[model samples]
Target: MGTRLQNKVAIITGSTSGIGRGCAELFAEEGAHVIVNDDGSRKGLGEEVVEHIKASGGSASFFRADVFQSEDLRKLIEYATETYGRLDILMNNAYKGHATSVLEQEEADWDMVFNSSVKAAFLGCKYALPAMIKAGAGSIINTASIHGLLGGLRHSAYASAKAAIVNLTRQMAVDYGKYGIRVNSICPGRIVTEGKIEFLKKYPEEVRRQQAVYPLRRPGTMREAASAALFLASEDASFVTGHALVVDGGLTAQLPDSVAEPLEEGLGLFRTE
Candidate 1:
């Protein structure tokens, strides 16, 4: 019912749940015909999302594809253009990675992470850009992460892939701007998804530890992350491009809690009770 993306056509990969689904639902709610995609890892879930959208009176459908494959990405683009006659928004949100250091990481894992995160974005643009160029305008949102900016302790592969995406987004914007295409990435910090809920439940200590670093004292919700995507996808960000808008709940804006906590205790910082 929002007009920000009224009548626009969008495709979001990895949309069975989490940030992908969040964007899919919100984009539909804003009147964009959304293509909710999954890697077939969650077939029923993808259909459930489409049904949810229709029930809510938003336009959406499901598309299953493995974004890591160039061919699959091409087909996805074709589906969007054939179904809707144009592609207005492309959000590459499908990702897979693990907490493994260089010493502990396997070559296959590294490649998988890169293929899922970086190559998929590349392929999405490769196929979607032509459709967008034909129309002379489009918005592409790549999901980077705070780990991409600050790097991660154990998230080496995922972080590296995200960093590549951040730069790739810039490169795409530089090359595609002449065609009126805007490319941008959002670097989210700790977002509260179902995975995080389970994580916190199992490792309860992380709850307080997570709350300490962020000025907001909490993790971000999917809706909040989706809102950031919405801004970059909609014409609201018409003048924005090649930007990595950090949505980290102020995590990157401050010192690490490990270092700052003791300093806080001594300096009476945040001591007000």
Candidate 2:
């Protein structure tokens, strides 16, 4: 069979690296023309991924813009329509600096997080929805986190923003479903990427404890999460919309009784794939 995304035009925000980068690469590999948006920093991950896609015989281009700004978002959307003539997939996958608990989070910090995470998604949908509506069908995939589905310590702003994204997904589905646009959110669990791996290295005990508690007894990979995103944005999930697909390696599924036994032994459910 040919690529699942052949001839499709996609816009993936914050795709300089990490999960967003993976999505951009995968989409381009499957034959979609991708617009990689980032802050245009010379050292940004977006440029790197664009290079990766181009080197792999895929078609992609980069746009430097801050996702938090409405103008920037509008520009990106307009660029897609003007250049590619249609926008098929819109993936909101950008995040910025955040810190500990709500008490420690400043007003500026909170604004920064919300603008980057929640506001960005809102603007992406706001601008891209019309194109989808006109085209008669499209996919909008918001990158949420397991924290959005449940509580976690020292992640108030990120959690709140992500929770908003999940709700926004539902609301968009309700409002735009009639227009043939499918909206959904993906809640990714603990996945070991370069940043996370380095962060975890600073806390060996916590990493070990997390590994033990996960049913898979390990963290996930960026590519695995990207694959799930692909499925949501593809015709394979044509009938699926307004859903929060949690890819947490069973971490969120571990209940009190389920974890009591494992916790007692300093291990988790330890299931295999």
Candidate 3:
């Protein structure tokens, strides 16, 4: 029953699933009118998410645009302004290119990764700023990752993109603070989503072993990350900007010091079910 974002107009890109979808749904639940922006290639999941929101008595609409296209990004902002008369939040979250390793990653793959990931954040802010300036205030949340601050075995491009986003968040906040626009980034650790779940299904043993090292002994849920976004987007975080809020179940904060151990009975990162 929290109306923290009552009447705000928000656009969340890559909202077909994962963190973006979580943000869109939670924003709606918090009384923000949401634009469910998707790249339109997912298997009807994006539109279905919009339907789920409306079905829950939350306000939402869908827009399909490839974030790599400048024109599409422009139209996305336009759609928000046209549909809602003002845009209060812009979430840059679409990305492609998950390579096995930096050495194995191709040049074209590197280009595509930055183009869709970091470039979208850069460009989305470039375009969304005007509308937000006109509205007098807005929030922009970018999806960073634990890899941004730390690193992973085979995520050079993704890690770099996220790292850049964290810095971009700071730059935007500093540049636009006078204009009442707040920009921040979220560096989520492992969040269990349909995509990750599918990946896990393909490598069950590795996933289980990977899950063991975390202090939480489990991955985060999408809703948990979305709730953090809700706080940043709402008035509750009015004084917060240019920060990367890590939602990693204390993994980054504590687990690195602990000996890598298999899940022991009663000793876990999550609450015992």
Whole-model lDDT per candidate = 0.89, 0.87, 0.86
Which has the higher TM-score value, candidate number 1 or candidate number 2?
1
Estimated TM-score per prediction?
0.94, 0.93, 0.92
- Expressed as tens digits, the lDDT of each residue in 160-269 for candidate 1 is 88999999999999999999999999999999887788987887656766666667777899999999999999989999999999998888887665547744554333
* TM-score computed on alpha carbons, candidate 2: 0.93
User: Where does model 3 exceed 4 Å of error?
Assistant: 261-273
Model 2, which residues run further than 4 Å from truth? 42-45, 267-273
Poorest lDDT segment (10 consecutive residues) of candidate 1: 264-273
On TM-score, the stronger of 2 and 3 is 2
Which residue pairs show backbone clashes in model 2? 16-45, 16-46, 212-268
lDDT of 1 at 72: 86
